[model samples]
Target: MQTTAKNALVSELRERIQHLEGGAVRSRTVLPFGVPAIDSVLPSGGLAYGALHEVAGGGSGTVDGAAAALFVAGIAARTKGKIVWCLTRPDLFFPALAQVGLRADRVVFVESDREEDVLANMLEALSYGGLGAVVGELVRLPMTASRRLQLAAEKTGTIGLAVRRWRRQTEAHDFGQPTASTTRWRVSVMPSEELPVPGVGRGRWLLELMRSRAGECAEFLVGACDDKGRIDISTRAGDRQDQTSRSVHSG
Candidate 1:
């Protein structure tokens, strides 16, 4: 018997399964991080909704990848439409997603045991072009496969997010391999701020824009996502500016 991930979800989002027609023209809008510090670094001035972008953790550990997932979640949460999340792992924590402002109502969870099926589903979802974004957790993405996904996204103008994951540290070397993704990012967990009164402050992250089509590759230290699904850079805005200036190289 064939298995469908949407049919195996909890009650809250179970009925979200629906059909979509391929190749509808959508506005080629972008999802901007809103902070000038971040948006100014992107070629499109924002994350183009109709393109393929890849993200990975700084390490191969599970916690490391979860940070990448949350980063993807925060992006999707800020969009205006529904989302399709294709994953091979069933360990996606709803409460944790909710904590990042990705509510259950806005997502359709598709859980599969095979990575091939997940990849195929991601292509189909992106080709459909009806959702705010189509996110897939992928352990490996070859150049040919990424090219196909990128084309599919371009035709329909949908956000295609590929969350690159690795079970072992050695496998992470594939991240250096070539792909057609427009942008590649590496997010790592950093220590949270320590309050003056002995309390925990907001989480921190080392966000590295590893590669981009027409932007600079830079690293940023910023506060983690807040309840409204925004990454705060106010704390390190000045420092980031200075660093960027010092490292600015002419191509």
Candidate 2:
């Protein structure tokens, strides 16, 4: 009887594995970073599955200029399910997140008092395998606890985003820094460009694609996120047109 039960259990496990690999399970996907030029450089249209991505602030003379947290929310809006937002800051401003297309209903917000607790909770959520992605904000130095979260995310294919908030000088000392992540980025606000419409203009972000596993260094001025969490590439389109015009004139 024992031998027969063991055989049945093995068959069930095999069937489960097949379901996960055969597309019976929902495939993990990421939002397109809301920028076409930036998206092209990523391995899988956006941040890859089961990898840590970093975003650092402090450029263009603003602390949270383009708001890295909102960018994560914008990506969450594009994904198909709920997302876990773990942060140390109490003033996250849910209304701002909502404006970027992340519904209040789908977000599980957890405010942490300590960095270690924040990282731990994020790892727990990632291991649950129910979230579309996991976001953690790191404000201080690095901790040994982050490796646990990293391993858990790797095992479950959870896309982890770490936003560094404190300082550019000490960012190298943070838990998510020093080239541990698969991708590292710095987003900052540049001067907004005047659009065709009077008094209506679109902002620009200096997206420094600092590190990636498979792509070379590529940078672009990405349009700011609109109310719908989408970025219109009319600015980039104009640049392309100018390039084409210059080539034609030279030829």
Candidate 3:
């Protein structure tokens, strides 16, 4: 009787695995951000794959810029294949990204002179597919340009990330324009948790999920990615704030 029960359990496990691989479990492909508070707000309980997503700094400055970059790096670290990072700026610190889980070895940086060129490179990379993710840094992303990137990502099932960086506050306002991206997020640096020992604590961010295709907008105060590039919701810093405070109208 014991041997028969073990055989039945093994068969059930194998069938479950097959069902997952056959795409019968989830209709749309998604990568869980690993934070339940954030994931629950998304339509598929995670960030959708084969789509374009945008991230921007909360304001115009180095600190805000670093927060946005680290946020994207954390997402890239969780992807499956090689990462293609296209940027016009050469000031990205490798060690900082490493701390967030995106290793230097897995990234291939593509430099361009113009922001337009950076978008072009991202589109090309997304079209090629098989890449873990494609990231681009741009100051201005027009609606038409974003639509192209979205189509390319959809075609190849590759994740495309656009990191918006603006030198001027006026330029940052352009993010309010509509785009073809499936989701839009804004990352702002927050004070780290105070430790009893009086040393540095885990990094923290105010993550705003401003837009989603089918999910409601939400905000999360979350700890930064650990060594494994996994971010967790901070229980100490619960989701505090009204809808008006968290709502970001990215139309």
Which pairs, if any, clash in model 3?
A: none
lDDT of 2 at 250: 9
**TM-scores, in order shown?**
0.83, 0.74, 0.84
Report lDDT (CA) for all predictions.
0.80, 0.66, 0.84
Could you give me the TM-score of model 2 versus the true structure?
A: 0.74
For 1-251, candidate 1 gives per-residue lDDT tens digits of 23455445543353433212223223336788977777888766788877899999884343349889888999888887889999988788888888888998999989888988888999999889778899999999999889999999987788899998877787888999989998888888877777669888888787888887766777777777776678867373334554244224222
Best by lDDT: 3
Pull out the clashing pairs in model 2: 142-175
lDDT by residue (128-245, candidate 2, tens digit) is 8757788888765253555666667667777777777663544444534454566777667666787677785666666566677666456556676767777554464445442112
Model 1 regions lying over 4 Å from their true place:
1-28, 59-64, 234-251
**Per-residue CA lDDT of candidate 3, range 37-143, in tens?**
67877878898888999999884343347888888999999998999999988889999999989999999999999998998899899999999999999888899
Runs off by more than 4 Å, candidate 3? 1-27, 59-64, 237-251
Question: Which 10 residues in a row give candidate 3 its minimum summed lDDT?
Answer: 242-251
